[model samples]
Target chain A: MTAHASPIGPGPTGPGPTAPPPAPPAVSPLRLVATLGISGALAGLLLVSVHRVTEPVIAAHKQRVLEDAVLEVLAGPTSYRTLYLVDGAFTPDLPAGADPRTLDTVYAGLGDDGARLDGFAIPASKPGFQDKVSLLFGWEPKDGTVRAIRVLESRETPGLGDRIEKDPAFAAGFVGRTTPLVGVKAGRGTGAPSEVDMITGATISSRTVIDAIDTTLARLRPALDAYAAEAAR
Target chain B: MKETTAREDLLRGIWRENPVLVQMLGLCPTLAVTNSVANSLAMGIATAFVLLGSSVLVASVKRLVPGEVRISAYVLIIATFVTVADMALEALAPGIHKALGAFIALIVVNCIILGRQEAFASKRPVGRAALDALGTGAGFVIALVLMGSVREVLGSGSFLGHPLFGAHYEPWVVMILPPGGFLTLGSILIALSWLRRRRAAAAGEARS
Candidate 1:
């Protein structure tokens, strides 16, 4: 087979063909298999080596990011522990044979005394304008209000819908807001305990954030209340 | 096979045949990540690394592969390099990696890297292939940065992350959005063609 010419290049400039090129020799199947096998093996070896080297680093980076987000939402908790919900109850330890990734989990933060419960940083995600928007918010059971919020992941439209994450004003509006939060027009928030001003051009995305929190709280509030009561006891 | 000088191979992709601006290859990543200068630079460097590494490997192993499996072999090599780039970026520069997101993995399918392996690297010596890859990589970087600068300044009223026009400047929000990418790229293409035509006209006038 003739070599495929690239249109990106200045077309073939080989020495002026004095005559037509000679017919190419046929290739054997054995050589083709050998070539592919060798290539695959080499590729595998390179990937394995790189993966081994970077796996720990990538894991550490992810761990740090999660910890930082949790701490930020929880307002500098002295310590935090992962709690998994299984069979209608929250457990501090992972259940046998259950992947931590697939289970509902929250990070419970402790105050400076290391024994007093500060609050919980709960992560939730829901469909937004472009893709799923994932976020973490601190829920204070004492006051039954959202303490702080941070957007962990989002693919919203930049400079518009993305303001749900990038705009501090929008994020601040969620702080100290009660459940069943109401989204009002921008600059029209009545300063009520549960009122949040939606971003001007990102009403849907803004609402998605509120809805995700509300849905998550509705599903997990009973379990959280039980956990809080047990801790109080 | 054509005999390309080292200089020609090194310089061709930069201006005469830029991968993004001139040839329009890899436009997906070009448009997706060029909203900010930092993201654009990270993407450019990552793509350049993959292209250069794959070109060298393909050139070194050109003789061993039969024509029937050349494409597969090249893809395997390119994918390996892309994976390595992805891992390294995630570990070393997590922020940039997060900003780039799926575009880094999408580099595996970029036509520019595979196109070079098929056309230039497979047919040329190792040195020539390396030079060509560097040239193409540089061209890609320049085009991305150019688009990024225009979009960031107009879209956010900032260059990089620093505000350029103070607080009063009202950013043309459309410049940084999806439409901004296309608008900036189209404007650049128009400007490039206009420049080329002007140069051609000048040359014609001199000749006449």
Candidate 2:
């Protein structure tokens, strides 16, 4: 009968060896450990490489957003010329044609001459009721004005204090206002033609915007003057 | 492990061998990136890429790894793939990358990667391990996208950048906050459980 069963496990009648004997329950501990360690090292290297590659693209995107804001604030047929830090030694590197007027706060995109493009304004941040509030303002040296204002960052309450951001009439009030903007009540005539209307419930936020402008001008005026003087020469 | 039947291997991640909703693994990335659709999608892609890459490499070298120090070995392999995803994000789309912040780096701790290595990849053939990783990763991506869409729509009135609702929507701003993240997840889990129970009852009726 050709034995009818293979011999290897528990002999012919007990259990068939042809069944593969459960493959001896191979544990293979050494193989598992080594594979894991080597695989981990490779993955680490891959993560580092990808992070390095994406950093610049992200920065430029923010710059683009800022540039869009700057255009709303600057005046005349002007274009962004260049920036020079009053304190930084790199001021010497200011481009030859750069008007050197703007570039107080950053995130503004640079124009052809390496100056901040005319359309974008400086982005500034300051402490507000709960957290930091950031704003963008157009710095138009032509009339020595801050053309417009927009809130870029805030963490105030949504319906209450956040009304500062919620109310467009409040933001629209700041447009075309000259430097050193004075803020006041919205109705009954208190502002210069360029004066901004205050947010009814969020006086603190309104004040923060006014102060950021004050602070920006405190530092930005000198830089603007230098550029204006050069433009005249 | 014995070479799994094709159907069984594919079904593992759904329930009996789930990496997240069932096993409660990978909670850190799960919570941190579920705030918005963009964030969740980015995280899901990075993880899937890492899982796929590492699983294949581990399975290919299964015979070479020593048994004594496998855990350390597995971590090193996973970290390498994560680095690749990070650099790509940093270089190509830095805004999204910056928005995601440290959570991308934290993908290294995600239990999904290590679990696959220990439970399936180490024992399986290279091809099987890679496919298994892909399936599990796709499942994870689906979960993240679902979670992020709910949060973004409820939290911001925006779904993948479109105004899904009109201006009157209140946008439950809390949906974007940390507490909202926890609350949304709890509700999602409850909904998932109700679905499972209904499905089970239907199946039992059919059997009877």
Candidate 3:
């Protein structure tokens, strides 16, 4: 192998022209088995130790991020009450009022001390270019004006569609808008009372954000009216 | 214990054995995190730190790793270093830690680290293995940074969040999307192939 490698017409430079390196002497199977056993045990030990130490911190950060998003939607004076949606109509849960798991959602924000501040709808689904546009929306108690829109997850193309998640201007539009499938007009900003600016070159993205808001708002308004009527009575 | 050839361990990883452009290892970070020079730099250094730690530990214990279960054992070792990296990043730079998201934990699957231990580190002296790991890590960083800078400049009209081109330069919206990553990487590969052919032709002329 050494003699063959020495010179093969000026020695191979490219991978196609080059020769494989000389093979090293082989060892016995028993030795290989012992080596594997020891390494496996040691590596497993180190991994578990590290995971135990870091799990808390990782979990805390994740929790904090979610809390912050929820709170942002529930802004102003607030309290979070767990509600059971028994049959998809803001109803309560399983085990007979044991905080229904099958269809329960977190109804957030009363007042400084259980006073009525506002109500929010947590609408989560995969849509748009990347298939994960999770959002939290706060609608005012009456008229369903949008108070805020919080993006939880999205994988849209940066600059174009990602503007939905990152651009303050695009998000600022979501605030103060009243609902029903109305995407902000292309190019120039729409001068309507409930309108936001569409991204300059992302028509598909603009439509997605509008559709998400529209769908969420459509379901929310009727339920919100029912809740309002319940409160009045 | 017998030692492996240093030249084989070194040059193999740099080109024909590259961890990113050639080997196509660790595509998640290669695409998601490489959006800017700053992001790429942060990811690169984090990766290099983990590679160094894991290579040392894996090589030291190579004699004991069972051949039948080496793959599982290698993942265990790699995961530990990745956790250490995650912890350090969280403590020192919480901002970057959030920005990186699951990519930090995803490093557990990064083929560069495991590929080194399985192919080179476990079979070689500790020092030579470290050098090979460093070379491969460094090459990956360079490729990531290059890819990120190209996208940031063309897509967002910024460089590390700073403006390089004036407002007159219209942003190429497609450059920051998923397709943009593939686009830039493809063109770069073509350019690299072209350069190699030009260099090879030059060499042949001199020889003749």
lDDT of each: 0.87, 0.68, 0.69
List model 3 lDDT by residue over A105-183, tens digit each: 5455566667453566465454788676877766665766777777767877765788788887777777877765366
lDDT of 1 at A208: 95
Q: Give residue B192's error in model 3 in angstroms.
A: 2.5
TM, every model: 0.89, 0.70, 0.74
Cα distance off (Å), candidate 2, residue B140: 1.1
- lDDT by residue (B127-157, candidate 1, tens digit) is 9889999999999999899999999999888
Candidate 3 C-alpha lDDT tens digits along B1-208: 3344667656665666566666566666888887677878889888887887778777786766555556666777777678778886875677788778888888877766766676666766688778787778887788788888999899878988898888787888777767788888878878977897999999999999
CA shift of A144, model 3, Å: 2.4
* Model 3 stretches with alpha carbons more than 4 Å out: A1-49, A78-104, A114-117, A184-201, A217-233, B1-18, B21-32, B83-109
Top-scoring candidate (lDDT): 1
As for lDDT, the candidate ahead, 1 or 3, is 1
Please compute DockQ, using alpha carbons, for every candidate against the native two-chain complex: 0.44, 0.33, 0.27
lDDT for A26 in candidate 3 is: 68
Q: What is the lDDT for B139 in model 3?
A: 73
Could you give candidate 2's per-residue lDDT for residues B20-115 as a string of tens digits? 565556666777778789989999989989889889988887666665555666677777777777777776667678778788888887877876
Rank order (by lDDT, best first): 1, 3, 2
Q: Looking at candidate 3, what TM-score does chain B attain?
A: 0.87
| Model 3 RMSD, rounded to 1 decimal | 6.5
**Which whole-number lDDT from 0 to 100 does residue A160 have in model 2?**
51
